[model samples]
Structures are given as structure tokens and as C-alpha cells.
Target: MSRFPILPRHQSGFAYIAAVIFLVVIAGIAVVLLRLTETQQSTVNQALLASRASLAARGGIEWVFNNPVQRCSQAPLSTSNAAPAGAVNHLTDFRAESGFLVSVSCSFRAYNEGEAIDASGNSSPVVKRIYRIDAVACNGTANTCPDTGSVPRADYVERAQVATICLLTDGAPCV
Candidate 1:
């Protein structure tokens, strides 16, 4: 009765189903790209924070080294014990940025090396003082070095630096 043979109608709405599948795949790829971008941004931020922390720690070390007389005087050698206790100094928010804090620890030891003849032809003991310094910088609380808060944060950063210096004392107090 039909002029033209009717094709099978089982393929009805095939285009709609195909379109939905394509949309879902495209959305999934978009989500993946967004997530990857976010992760990369986080890594870059962490690296920058780390660099800031390192520079802050170096600044603390230099500060202590420059003011040896005052700092060494504060760290008195202990006679009671063979090993003296070191002195710890804190410079809260010392860096240009408000997020950074620096803490410097110093220890001093005096020892007599070999005998030396002075210009007056008098023999004198050569006294040498050794200074051990450590500087720690952190983006934690304004008053502390390491972040000791109960809640741990992914953005927290910290760096530590150390140096040792030896000075010859000519019968005077070693700074």
C-alpha cells in the first residue's frame, strides 16, 4: 500500500543519545583540566613561600653575626656544666612581610690554643672563642619559629640556617 518501503524505526532518537554521551565526555575532560590547573597553582604558591622563608632565615643569621658583642654577652658560658646552654632570641615579624618570623639561637665557647709571644716579649696564651649560631624562620605565628598550632595547614612554611665563627681573643673578652 505504501509508495516507498518504510525503513526500520528502531533507530529513533539515536542522535539525542549520541549528543548526551558527547556532552558528558566533554564535561569530564573540562573538570579534569580545571583540577590540574588548581594543583599547579598550589605548587607555585608553595615554592614562593619557601623562598621567602629561606631569605628571612638568612636575614636573622646576618643580624646575629653583625651584633656579636651584644649577643655573645647575653649568652654567658656556664661553669656548672661542661656544656653550656645556648641563648635563644626571637625577632617576631622581623621580615618586611608580616607573615614571617625569625628566631636566632647562639652558643659560645672559649678555649686557649697555643702560647704566643707578644710585642713586649712576654708569652701569653692565645684565647679563641667559638660561636655557633642557628636561625629559623617560619610563616607560622608571629612569635614562634615552627608552627605549633593544633590545626595543620598546607600553606605553612619554615626554613633553618646555621653558621659557626671563630675569633682570636687577645687577652680580652671574646665577642
Candidate 2:
């Protein structure tokens, strides 16, 4: 007797239920997309940090080469107690500029590769000094590189670079 016809009992709230389900599915998709975007952003940020660390490490190596005091001097095996003064100062400067800690180590090896003629037309032993230089850059709370003291951070980044340099001297070792 009413103006509208009565719907079946089982299908009374069909539209409402369907709308709810659709909303839930849409929300799930949105959440997944948001998570994906966040993950991509995180990856990009990590890449940037890694690039900065690499640049810092390379800069440290260049500093070692350019600095007269640390050029061929033997680096201490452990930086816990005493690192080269020049290296430490350079690291400090870089930290201020790029918020990264850089540590540099170097070792020298000498080899005699037969003999060579000098400008004076005198033959002398060709002393080859091979310098192995290593630089480690990290964003950590530890005082030195390799960040052993601090807890693992999701945003932490580190980079290492090695450079080998050979210098030929006239029967002289690289001191």
C-alpha cells in the first residue's frame, strides 16, 4: 500500500554494503600507492647520501695528495689514538661542509725496476714507490670511520675509495 515497493530482506542494504566494500578497496589501493611512493623517496634520498659520501671520500684522498705533510708519510693503522694532523683537520673541514666524517690511510712500497737514464746521461736504479691510499667516508656518530659504536640507522651511508700512485725516483725511497 506504500508508494515504493518493498525490497527483499537479503538485499535490503545491498547498495550500502557495496559502497562500503568499494571504499575499503579504494583505501587499500591508496595505502599501497602511498607506501610505494614513500619507498621510492627513501631510495632516492639514500642515493643522494651515498653520492655525498663518495664525494667526501674522494676529496679526502685529494687532500692527502695535495697536503705536503701527509703526502708520503705512513698512516697509522688505527685512528683510535692518533691520526695524521693534516688528515684530521681536513676531515673536520669536510664535516662542516658536508656532514660526513672522512678517514684516510696510506701505505708506501718501494720497488727497484732495473735502471733508467737521467737527464745528465747517468744510469741510476729506477726506484718505484707505490702508495696505496684508502679513504672512508661515513655519516655516523662514532669518532672514527666504519661507525662501529652507533646503532644501525636507516638513513646511514658510507663510501670507500682507494687510489694507488706510483712515483719513480732515482734510487730513493719514498719517506
Instruction: For each candidate in the order shown, give its overall lDDT on alpha carbons.
Output: 0.75, 0.74
- The sequence of per-residue lDDT tens digits that candidate 2 reaches over residues 60-141 is 8898777423464545222122323333333767788999999887766656778778799999776666667788999888
Backbone clashes in candidate 2 total 0
Residue-level lDDT tens digits of model 1 in 48-134: 989988888898889877866467554343221222456677876475465688888877677777888979999977767776788
Clashing pairs in 2: none
Q: Top model by lDDT, which number?
A: 1
Considering every candidate listed, which one attains the maximal TM-score?
1
What TM-score does structure 2 among the candidates reach?
0.76
Candidate 1 clashing pairs, residues 3+ apart or interchain: none
What candidate 1 gets wrong by more than 4 Å, as runs, is 1-10, 75-85, 93-98, 170-175
Could you tell me every candidate's TM-score relative to the true structure?
0.80, 0.76
